[model samples]
Target: MNCLLFTWRKGDGKLKIHEVRKQLTTPLGAPAYPWGPYNFRNREYLNILYRTDMEALRRVVPEPLAIDEPLVKFEVMYMPDAPGLGAYTEAGQVIPVSFNGEKGEYLHAMYVDNHPAIAVGREVSAYPKKLGAPRLYIDSDTLVGTLDYGSLRVATATMGYKHQPMDLALARQELSQPTFMLKIVPNTDGSQKVCQLMRTQINNPTIHGAWTAPARLQLFAHALAPMADLPVLEVISASHIITDLTLSKPDVIYDYLAEH
Candidate 1:
């Protein structure tokens, strides 16, 4: 069966433009496809889990959702190849949040090199995705990543690779949990078009390797995007996981514009 993307009546005529869906999953009937023709082989992740000030955390986190433990996860992923979207690198910040008593990870800021991935991520899950130059590489025993906004370096993270083996079961469980994000779009007239809370879960993720070590995270102030607002207080854990994760369906939790 074919799916319809969008339709608009032109002038007084009934001529309409319709596009067929290509990707496996889409929003209800939206012409857009599900993110990822996702298959990752030896995908590398260098992550740092750290504690931050409660005040700093509160400022960055949106209302209605409360911070769980003032913790933040900064991760760098090197995807040599991915389905649909080609090779790309990504770095981002995630906060431990609880909404309506349900615990989930909230995506704070995500930067990637590919435009297609950014577009699809925003459309599908309301992910706060931005286009930037991000690189993840291994140098000797250290795994490092940097996010660059034009010429300015905004974030950096480093970790010791495979320093210690992590419990595969616990690591898998943590990676498989649900994640929340804010999906916001503006109308042409400069008004809020869509603002909603989005929830998504990982699908059939296979963990091939998992390692842990002490890590470091740094965020610098940017004139455009201020990631430094979420200051780091203490480094909790650093982990590296090689796995393949499928981006699953997204569910909208709350619509801010809905009239009760």
Candidate 2:
């Protein structure tokens, strides 16, 4: 399990890379092994990659006792609201996004894993700590939801898991992780309530290899009492995996799976 860190600075447009090393040990007095020397530049990118690995561990691990090797890559794009968070520009690199929302800036982190974690019970300890709760909406069998961060809305959708077909396995898997939890919170305006919490293990291979479990929308009112009177608009979080890019070469993936 190698982890790469990609750091983005908004001012000068620079991307720095760093490698993180972790020791995986067994009970015996001998050396268990060294998992990484992963490359990355910052913490936000690390968080995104960590979440991806956590999801893979939960949904795709067919066996419990096996050890899997996954090659991972990450990219972080930061649109800073204020200075001093290490937002500096570099020569030749262009800023990937603009600051259009009220928040004034946004941070978008993208993670790509070539060989991701595929262990059933073996947990990846690198999951994110600041993920917001998902708001879930279902129309017939389709699953749709939004993740609200103050005034910002992150939208997500899930068709279902492969084995279960129509079942929302990704949502269930996310709800099942001990580290991940969901709760209803009032929105900034007292008018409504929204879901608040973080999620883990929400990926399924059957449906585009992407899935999201949203929090309940009504809870926003109760969670943020002071803002109950404010107008609420539906917003969507744009987090999703392009399966063709992420899960290409099924034969190769299966071959790697078989080797493990």
Candidate 3:
């Protein structure tokens, strides 16, 4: 009989059989960072809330998350110094919802530059993240965000930067609310491996600056990230803010795969 040995590779070195690998995350293994300083600084965000089709909105929202309004928030964020995820730009669509009698936001789709952010976001926070090029930058006097899926541009948003100052206390209170997501991981047999509604909040967020302004949003119909599904009915509100926050741990609110 012959015995074989297996080893894993690390940065500039190799791991011996006896040495245990790091536990970063459960789903993807050692690469995912479970805990972090998980902090963000000078994180600039542009949020555009627009009214969408009520019937179209109902199709995507999961159970227990009732539509509070027919509004969806399209956000573009620039995280210059995110402790764990590093510097990255994120763009996503979050819908206004009510869960368990409390009003909150629900993540529908997200796109980011970094791979680690995508993996950990999906695994821990139940964020529906996909890899793409999303950027937030200042073009002339306007704050802009654009998302590109491959060579195709999916969405673009532009707003007047700090055109109107909002009350700081009011902004702080709005930033403290928890956000929800529907997490579904399928099994090899096409059944659900894990299905649940998750709740995660940005803890102790300090809004250093906030401003409200007129904004415009353009969403294209792409099969990969169909942002056009919502179909904007009216532009409700738009705002830009700079904040420092902590990405806190998540709590399971509802289990879809659980037995009755």
Candidate 4:
């Protein structure tokens, strides 16, 4: 058929294949986000460290990573300006874990209000990022952070405004720890294509300011957003930090399906 021949001719484009091969991200011509390393200028964070149930912590953390303690960090972050991804608000829960005797934090659950952030986080790294409503701002005398999923508030955190200044050296040391994540990509036939533990370490970031404050956090039960699954037992410590940092691309450390 002439129509069939025309369609085949239209479909047979040689340059597009070469162009796609040379590209960095998804889509043939248009990418959702630009290539990394994404730089954040004056990134602010409201980090709330709390104690949680040890048994609950073991359920989500995968193998090879030993739970350092019965602890979880609830963080709400606001980025003023990010190149290629623009500014976005993010909030999530991370668990402190140890891999081969080295202390690190595991990427558990992250929610961002920006599409580019959600795409880049999952596509590039194994970051468990989803699209949700997260806000980080300051009220009259308290710093407030909240996460909402479909009109239901999943987590809320409040902190006193900058009570004591945190030492910059100690802050940098804490931030430089390696972050581990489970990267799982499925194959076309629904079988497992890729399952590995990925790691990334942030190093030599310029810290602008850091502070510790009395704070409180509450996690509500949500079917989709399972921040309450860990069940915050007690608020241990809280910190509000502002810094300029760079997000590093992850490297595969352990392949779950590798030969024994």
Candidate 5:
């Protein structure tokens, strides 16, 4: 199959072959998203790691990626100075898994409040990102993170703000690992045209401030955003971090379905 791109004329609405093969992204004249690698500064995070059931972990993590542990990382990010994506808040769930003996996190579900952020994330890197309401802020001495899909609450997390300085070196190492996700692009016939596992990681992250704290996480069942599908049995660890980093595109690791 061949890939073709075209646009419409201004007045008569005639089809114009204005395709630039190597040009960043699609829809020609007015691209909705900016081309990366995007830079971010003062990116704040409220990460709460929790334990879950092994059966639940196995159901979400795909094959070729083994479940390293029955653990899930519930994270809420506040991007204050993201260059291309603008300032937005995002929250998601990630699972600990290993691909071909390499340990990494599998991005299960993510929601952002920014339009461009959601567009770029889903189209560019194929990150499982959606447009949902997520917020991160400080309330009194607690760092709060909440996610909502429409009018229903999906998740809520709270931590003691700057309770104790975290191990920066360890935090940096953990953040450097590649994350795996599946990309599905459907064809006109309702068949999957592109189905593959993609790998992406933070390019270079500079941790400005990091801390560990006592935290709690509450996940509610939702129809659209089913984050609570992976139940939180116990909260393991929590971290609040401020960092600067760059976002890079993902590389296709494994093809799940091929057009024959």
Candidate 6:
């Protein structure tokens, strides 16, 4: 699966273009910083693109096989930091995302399988203390769908940090809070067939080292949607359980790692 993660800081006032540029140019442990084009003069925003693989993804993801699509994408927007309540604003907003470097003003919608009692436990889970939990617009088991104009669907997923730990304390913290994992399946050809999969993260307070989930089931749906005459594949969501904890040192570090 080829996935792209895009992050945007609240450019309102705290994060200027220069600071963003410096952060990108001088990331904590990287010897050489990665830089990209940002309309700094206009103070638009900065974007960093990461081409990663499965082994790297498994470090943070609890369920990798559940996501089997080829193109996964996500967008993070910096919420306007309001005094006292600023951090809460960005808690559960689904910022638009472009996949495969495609961008434009497009229509987009979301469908969430609604389930009851799912929100009760998510309230304080690692989410920003100020923003609180999302509004619980729909149930997880209930199928709520939307129509949009974008070429791709960016989906996001959240595993209970307390339930599943991903080395990073912040991720664990956010997991402590109520977070939603998204699965975006593009709708084309006027059929309910999902074209591609897009993944993303939502309601995270801190901004660094964030990752996006893969769109595996969405891709499978798209492939199978066309052949309605064939037996439809069943996709199920299981608990976020992590097992087999082990650490092994690599024999050698390659100068460059290629994407599959």
Best by lDDT: 4
Q: Name the lDDT of candidate 5.
A: 0.88
Residue lDDT tens for model 4, 9-128 = 336655554455688787757899988889999999899999999999999999999997899999999999999999999999989999999899998999999998988888878989
State in Å the error of residue 174, model 3. 2.9
Tell me, by TM-score, which candidate is best.
4
lDDT of each: 0.80, 0.25, 0.85, 0.90, 0.88, 0.23
Residue 38, model 2: lDDT of: 22
Regions of candidate 3 where Cα sits further than 4 Å from its true position:
1-22, 25-34
> What ranking of all candidate models by TM-score puts the best one first?
4, 5, 3, 1, 2, 6
lDDT of 6 by residue, 1-260 (tens): 23223334665455554555555323345412122211111111011122234343333223212223211221122223222222211111121223334321111212212111112111211111121122111134221111111233322223222223234454334322322232222346554322222232222233234322221122111221111111113322212211111111111111112232
Could you give candidate 5's per-residue lDDT for residues 1-260 as a string of tens digits?
43433444566655444535555676677677878778899999899999999998888888888997789999999999987778899999989888999889999999999988888888777889988999998899999999999888899999999989999997897788889998888999999889899998985699999999999999999878988889999999999989999876789999988533
**TM-score for candidate 1:** 0.85
Misplaced by over 4 Å in model 4 are: 1-14
lDDT of 1 by residue, 167-193 (tens): 988778778767988988899988999
Q: Give the TM-score comparing model 4 with the true structure, all chains together.
A: 0.93
TM-scores, each model vs. reference: 0.85, 0.20, 0.88, 0.93, 0.91, 0.19
All models, RMSD in angstroms: 5.4, 22.3, 4.4, 3.4, 3.2, 19.0
Better of 2 and 4 by lDDT: 4
Better of 1 and 6 by TM-score: 1
Better of 1 and 4 by lDDT: 4
How far residue 153's Cα lies from its native spot in candidate 2, in Å, is 14
